[model samples]
Target: MLSKSHLKALSFIREFIVHEGYAPTLSEIALGIGIRSKGVVHRYVQALAQEGVIELHAGRKRGITLPEPNKERDMTLPLAGRIAAGRPIEAIEDQVRVDLAAFFIGPGRFALQVCGDSMEEAGILDGDMVVVAQQEHAADGDIVVALIDNEEATLKYLRRNPQGDISLIPANSAMVPMVYAAERVRIQGVVVGQLRTYGKR
Candidate 1:
């Protein structure tokens, strides 16, 4: 965890680097955070460096640089290479994981390739990989991949019934929603983000 001032300084430094293409001077950072003291800003920067959240390049001016976050477990996901139709594919061991944090949040994330146009209206097209956050439950209207009766699975909007049933609603108006017993429906995961590729002309 970082202190409030430390976080503020990090934010300022990130925004400054993004817009200015370089790190800010301690004096500028002090002004950015309203500290009015370059010395205080230096100490904060030093603390951030000591915490391994940043680095201070020796013998260089405006050398403060943000370090990569020390999180590694969710940095990658198991890639099936090219697959997944109506069933969840088995994980391949000895496989290199492609960094997909760019697609979604949380550590329990996985990728699934779309095989149908049922979710096309929801902007999910065939061949797109949906990054899902692993969870057992989702709110109503959330697009989720639901395994019905521990066998057949479908991706659609989720809803409930007064009689304690689950409704799997598809985005395509040409398709009708399927209702099933709540006990038979298992939420595999909720859709968080998606990845798609375009062909070059």
Candidate 2:
């Protein structure tokens, strides 16, 4: 657990890095936090560094850097929810850590898990992990898990037919194509990585 002051400092540091693209100097941090003494900021920084929350670069214009955001096994963190296949699941406070590391192949990454056989043809199945790069849009032919009508999420190969109609293709031919307006689909993420369980039966 982190002290309230330390957490506040971390929040301030993250905001500064995001907006200013550099860690503020001790004096600047002190001013930002409305503290009178530079030593107080320095001590807080040192404490945060020791706690593995942030790092300081030696003799640089912007010395402070945020550690890569990683999930910790704790009860206070955000809980995950079920992926909607027919209708989007209502966002609720009940999910646990879904191991989002695989999705974050690089910066600005996120992840979600697969839930059904609607996409089995694509090798995505129930219990398989789906890593996705966070984005607002996807190119045609990309296998994406998308939100339809703001009610459900489903996985399919995205395509634009010759007639300029949008379709979600299931790799399994037995499964029919899902057609919808181009603007009706909301791409949550593109499937970039998958995890499978194996056992010789």
Candidate 3:
């Protein structure tokens, strides 16, 4: 966790580096953070460096630099309003950040690359990466990754019949659902989110 002053200094340094194409000096950072003492600003900078949020280079005029952004975590994107999927609608600009970490990263969460079209009708296509929340159980209607007889694994919708039987349902109409004894099917995880890539792999 970072204090308010630390966060402010970090924000200023980031914005300054982005606009100026180089890191700011301690004096510049002091001016940006509305602080009068260089020593105080240096203490904040040292603290940020200790936290691994920024790096310092010895004997350089502009020594501070931010680390590269992580690709697999803590990513955010602008939510620039909605578009109609069925009909034409007016475009409106909206300023909002969609934090990808909140949706895909969490305790016991993992991702699996989809292999088949069993879930095509559910808008989950082959080759898509599905994020799963690992657990031993799931609701009756949840799409889940299941281990069958502890031998084969598959993705399907879970259904519990009144007779204590389980059904692994597929989204494609061309395929039939698999019925198994409740003891034969082990719920590995539940589908939480998905990712698809366009163009060359």
- In model 1, the clashing pairs are none
- Write one digit per residue (lDDT tens) for candidate 2, span 77-136: 122345543333543334565443311334444455556676776677766766666576
Model 3 per-residue lDDT tens digits across residues 1-201: 356898799999999999999999888999998999999889899988766779899999998888767723344444333322111133243575445543354567666666667788999887676777879989989988877777567888889999999988888888888899999988878988877889876
lDDT of 1 at 89: 38
* Model 2's TM-score against the true structure: 0.53
Q: Measured by TM-score, how close is model 3 to the native structure? A: 0.53
Q: What is the C-alpha lDDT of each candidate?
A: 0.75, 0.68, 0.75
Report lDDT (Cα) of residue 136, candidate 1: 96
TM-score of each: 0.63, 0.53, 0.53
lDDT of model 1, residue 57? 98
What does candidate 1's lDDT look like per residue over 1-201, in tens digits? 356788789889889988999889988998898988888898999877765667899878889887666643445676433323333333232354556643253468777767777778898887888777779999999999787777565678899988999988878887778888899989978988888889841
Top-TM-score structure, candidate number? 1
Clash pairs of candidate 2? 79-95, 80-95, 80-96, 84-153, 87-151, 87-152, 88-151, 88-152
Measured with C-alpha atoms, the lDDT of residue 27 in candidate 2 is: 79
Q: Which of the two, 2 or 3, has more lDDT?
A: 3
| Candidate whose lDDT is highest | 3
Off by over 4 Å in 3: 1-102
Write down the worst ten-residue block by lDDT for model 2: 71-80
